[model samples]
Target: MISGDVDAELRRLADDPSFPHRDAARHAIRFRAEGDVSDLVAIEDDPHPCAMTDVVFAMAGSKRTWLNWVPMPAEAICNVANEVGSRRAEGEDLGLVSLALSAAEPASAITASERVMGRVELGIGDFPAPDIRMPLRRGRYAIWRYDGTDPVPAVPAPSGAAIRVLHEVGGEPWSSPLSGYVQAEPLGALPLADLLGLLAHLPGPPDTPRWEYLAKSTPTYWYRLLQPWVCLGILRHAADEPWATSTRREVLLDLALGIEDWTADAALFALVTAAYRESELRAEVHQVVRARLNAAASAPRLVTIEESLAHLMLITPGCTADDRALATAVLARAAEAGEEDEDEQAPPPSKAEKRRWWQRRG
Candidate 1:
């Protein structure tokens, strides 16, 4: 039978008495929609979310949406920039990674981003050194959260603090331990599940998937990753386990951020980014930067990092306000040390040389 016959049969089975028939029909429509996402996208403006969700799963789970969305629109619009009719207006979730990355406008768009988001924006730059970096450092998305019943005492204001405390809560029983670090003012604690529930609906890939996209640039990179399967003769395992677990993937990303190597370290630093709240792995992070800078070829970059490292270190959580103040002092001392070196290197003016030079100037 032709495609029309199959389509008709599927519609009939959608409400069929057979248990397997209805389920089969459901999967069939999804697979078919995934292959022709434009058909679904055309109706995205429809208010029927139940009908829309099926399309979302198909597009996210299959190649049809990701592989074909661009060409379909370009042919219709002549230029996607000049025309506004495409799915760009729909705001319907398609779960396409490239769409999200491109929607964020990746590079030039990030300069306008304010803190937390700002640091992450820097990570997308072409190359790091010699590029003018912004002075407005990013902030963490995670605000300081605390639990306690009694009111907590105020902590001293941060002198040269890196982490900008956006909001805070205290006065519950658990406030004592949390109060010392943050320059925390008081508020009521948000319910734990409510807080996480709010976060779960936010767009953007979980950390690992985003990193994987960045680390491997294109289809060729993905194919190369598959070479291990070809060599191992374990095609079944490779097919079954493509993505890393959430925990492992997040750790890899933190490791990537903490360490200064990898091909695009400069690029990563250029993006405005927000990590999980109160997260800092600075010692491990700086060590990676230090090691990279010490490499024979990267001397100038090292010098630049040495100049900037203290400031960057404080911005991550786990660093104290005292640590931040100390870093500021150390930078000042480094400047003084340079002046002393200049004085020490200069030759003492001999009496005869000083007189001759003065006379010539007059």
Candidate 2:
């Protein structure tokens, strides 16, 4: 049997008016100890989106810290779409995990997303598997989603095939010197500017399935190819150049502002790189990046800003002293904000004491 204190806490949470799906939370807690998630499927029948989300999180034993949760039911999947739509409408940053999980549910999730987000701009990893039948609407575009994961398959590409595809896509051929460098050092060690140069010719949006296939099959080349365009947009803005006039620049900016659109590592890299290149932009970059980090930290589930900063340091060891200091300050502020939020959400000490009594009895 579950501990009486846990049961009472679950009941209290279920009854909490702030969360719409009270009964779902209660019942979900009741059955959470069960090994199989199938029993929780009935919660999907509930019309309240929050209730379904609660049940899904409960079944998966996932704390609702971040906006995203896993083991989401197919029926509850639409809730994620609805949330994404609403957040995008309000001009808020959606969490990275939320977008990835939503993409995993391609059908209704995609439909709801397109209806709300309009002409969805997807990353390479964001593409639904080739088998997925996307709607016939015209506005969706495919760009690279750089998560820092080496998507390159173990098998080497057929001779000349990679170069042929690069030429076909209008991208510059990989340089022999850079190729030798990549072979010698870690792929992450490649210069950001060179990566941007390679991405210059790659066309944006309206990409074909063939292009997607080629990119996915040869992820390292695809990453090197696509990053230039994404990185250049940030660099342009950092240099105080006029970027608002360009539609491509607008898309790239939108992707940056919409935190869920790109991987956390990719987003951080762009911001940090921009800051590193243009000392003048460090303050602005710090503010923007801090806001997103704080937003993630403030979510119901705790996403440590420190972890993100640590990952950034590991991937981009060349970050300047100023960059490191700014990141450190941003993380400290985010941590403080998270603590304040937790204090606000926590029940009174008297209530906690009573709950402790129940725990002692159990």
Candidate 3:
């Protein structure tokens, strides 16, 4: 049974005419009933093409069912390829293309793979099929090939050609946002003190709506700035220090709460790392994060928030019970709203049909 808080949230979501959270809420409800989010895969059949790309990335990251991601539907793959093609043609960055190529089995997306390969071949003068070599249990490693072949023994690392392709298309322009700041120093480096100073000076909690702050600044600037710290263990290092000041913690927490859309991953990384070092801060961080997620659950673009949550669960597998519960509750609200919408739109079934549906399950 759904908890009272979750049920009330669902009711509020359902009654809202804007219906921003419809899809996510519905998926949540189904997840609660089925006990597995993957059970809602059928929802992908008619998803927005761009949203489907995000779904593909999310499913790939989910180690529990990564193998099943190979044979995605052809139409969906085509849509993603077309998006890549259009973006490439317009001279836009091909970061998404690189991700698609990395995650998809070339055989499963034969035609789309060919198109991407054609671009790489033309750009780099080679047909190197990039492979992601992942280490497995017991001193084993699995090499995933674009051609969908069985895993092979890890041998020589990926070729320079493949690495070049990844370099050219793998990341966004601001992948390292701190470069400019660090480079400005005479030594072309930023000390930890300076880095902390820069972070503290970033936009703080505002009296205006959070979205207004987001709109005024580049959406990903803060996340990009914080990512390096998260990756280099700087955030963790700071949290572990007994002398760490409240100023540092407050700056980090404010940034964490300010996160929305794609920046959620960075926030999760920072917050989770901080919480891991300071156990006392865990509950407070969870509360703040849950509130942020609840507010975003009703936004028009949920893919960013969804992907953020998925990445958080993926990285901190052992600490996700609370997050999972919160996710289920939010999704359940979406699901209930979906049912109401469907009920309003769908024609009433005959008594015989309803009886037959129930009888079939028995």
C-alpha root-mean-square deviation, candidate 3: 23.1
Clashing pairs in 2: 65-300, 65-301, 66-301, 196-228
**Which parts of model 2 are misplaced by more than 4 Å?**
1-229, 232-252, 263-265, 302-306, 313-362
TM-score, prediction 3: 0.32
Q: Give candidate 3's total backbone clashes.
A: 7
What TM-score does each of the candidates earn? 0.20, 0.28, 0.32
C-alpha lDDT score of every prediction, in listed order: 0.26, 0.36, 0.35
Clashing pairs in model 3, backbone N/Cα/C closer than 3 A:
25-334, 25-335, 26-334, 26-335, 28-331, 29-332, 106-146
Off by over 4 Å in 1: 1-272, 276-304, 341-362
C-alpha lDDT (0 to 100) for residue 74 of candidate 3: 21
Question: What value does the lDDT take at residue 177 in candidate 3?
Answer: 16
Residue range 136-183, candidate 1, lDDT tens digits: 122222111112211111222222111111111111111111111121
How far off is residue 139 in model 3, in Å?
A: 46
Model 2 Cα lDDT, one tens digit per residue, 127-199: 3232122211212222322233212121222223323332343243222111211222222222333323333
Worst 10 residues of 2 by lDDT: 353-362
RMSD per candidate (Å) reads 26.9, 23.4, 23.1
Q: Please name the candidate that would achieve the greatest TM-score relative to the true structure.
A: 3
